[model samples]
Target: MQNETTKIALLVAIATLIFLLVPVFLILYIRSYNRHKKNHFLEKQNMQQKFESEMLQTRVEVQDQTMQSIATELHDNVGQLLSLTTLTLNSVNVNDEEKARKKIDNSLALVNKSIKELRELAKLLHGEQLVESGIGHAIDQEINWLNKAGTYELKVNNHLVDLQITSPDKDLIILRLLQEIINNIIKHAQAKQIHIDTYLEKNKLHLKVADNGIGFDPNEMKMKKSGMGLNSIYKRIEMINGKLVLNSAPGEGTSISIEIPYP
Candidate 1:
């Protein structure tokens, strides 16, 4: 009887230990998961903050560029128009009825022309309202601007033209992404050729830009955290629930692919 009692007590102790250990293990697991979740959220927030700051700086630069063009227009075009209108008004005479009427009409016409030109300048003051027609035309416009340089041999296959859906919000962001990529190429790529392809497949929009440029190791960029250019791209991609793939190596050139959900 004594031996049987000892065995039974030993088994009970073993069972109690396992029961307590199961809950302990479960609590530790929950704590670990919660920590990971918190860290992810914090990282996302930091990235967003950085992206917003970068965007602010970019907007300021755009405004500065725009102001330069506006100043030129004011001097060369609008100023001349306004000056002519003033001369016409000053020459108006009441002595001769027909002459007075003609001068007044010319002045009115000149003033109206000036108003129209000023209105256009005002619109441009908004820092170039791009993609106004559609995403397709917008990309074409960017391509045309790049072509004017006569620097890169370009090959473009853009299927986004036939796409009927419109996502104005995403369109602007995507356009900016392309601009940033192109800017990087111009500043750093030393690229001789560029190939751009945008299309729709499997309910996702794909945009690819490849350049035969002097490439750098992407891993090194990440390790160095090379400024906000790449980080902004990644953060904006995340915000739109998009994906980006970047491939590059020393002397191998670079290719970037972006996929985003449609409207």
Candidate 2:
């Protein structure tokens, strides 16, 4: 009888211990979960901050590029036009009616051209708003500017102009990417023939730019860590989960193809 009583006491003690441990385990599990949740929230917030910072940088770069173009146009084209108009007017003689009439006509035409050029510059003032309509239109506008330079034989086929949906952040990043690529080409490609193509397929946006310019080995440049532009391109691509394929050789021209997720 004493042994049975002792066994019952032991069993009760074991049950009580287990009952106590279950709540302890539960509390520990809840605390661990809460910690994990907090950490996750912090990580997400950090990513958001990083994205906003990148956006700001991209915006500033775009504005800087616009301002540079405006300055160049003012000095090289409009300033020259206005200066020529001034010269033409100064040469006019009041005593020679017919000659003066011709000079006046020429000055009027020059002034009109200046006005048209200024109007175009006014449109460029909206460079930041270029992507508001759609990326397709924005890219076309860039191409139009390049065409104006008459520096290359350009072949462009852009189908994104009619795209119905948009992702604002992605659109801006993509436009900046294109701008960077074009700048690299203009600065280094030394190519007379350039081609650009963009389209949407299977929920992916595709961009391909090729030029018949002097090209360098991609692997060599990457090994040397010499291409800041290339590094920037890779970083931006990673941020947006895009893919890049670049082909180049010493004598062969360069081709860059990019694929990005779309809305």
Off-target runs (Cα >4 Å) in candidate 2 are: 1-10, 226-228
Worst 10 residues of 2 by lDDT: 123-132
- lDDT for every model? 0.80, 0.90
Positional deviation of 210 in candidate 1, in angstroms? Answer: 0.5
Model 1 deviation from the true structure expressed as Cα RMSD, one decimal place: 7.2
Candidate 1 CA-lDDT value: 0.80
Candidate 1 TM-score, C-alpha based: 0.56
* Model 2: number of backbone collisions: 0
lDDT (Cα, 0-100) at 75 in candidate 2 = 92
- Write one digit per residue (lDDT tens) for candidate 1, span 181-215: 98899889999999999998888889899999999
Tens digit per residue, CA lDDT, model 2, 117-215? 898888678876778778888888788778878889999999999999888788888888988989988998889999999999999999999999998
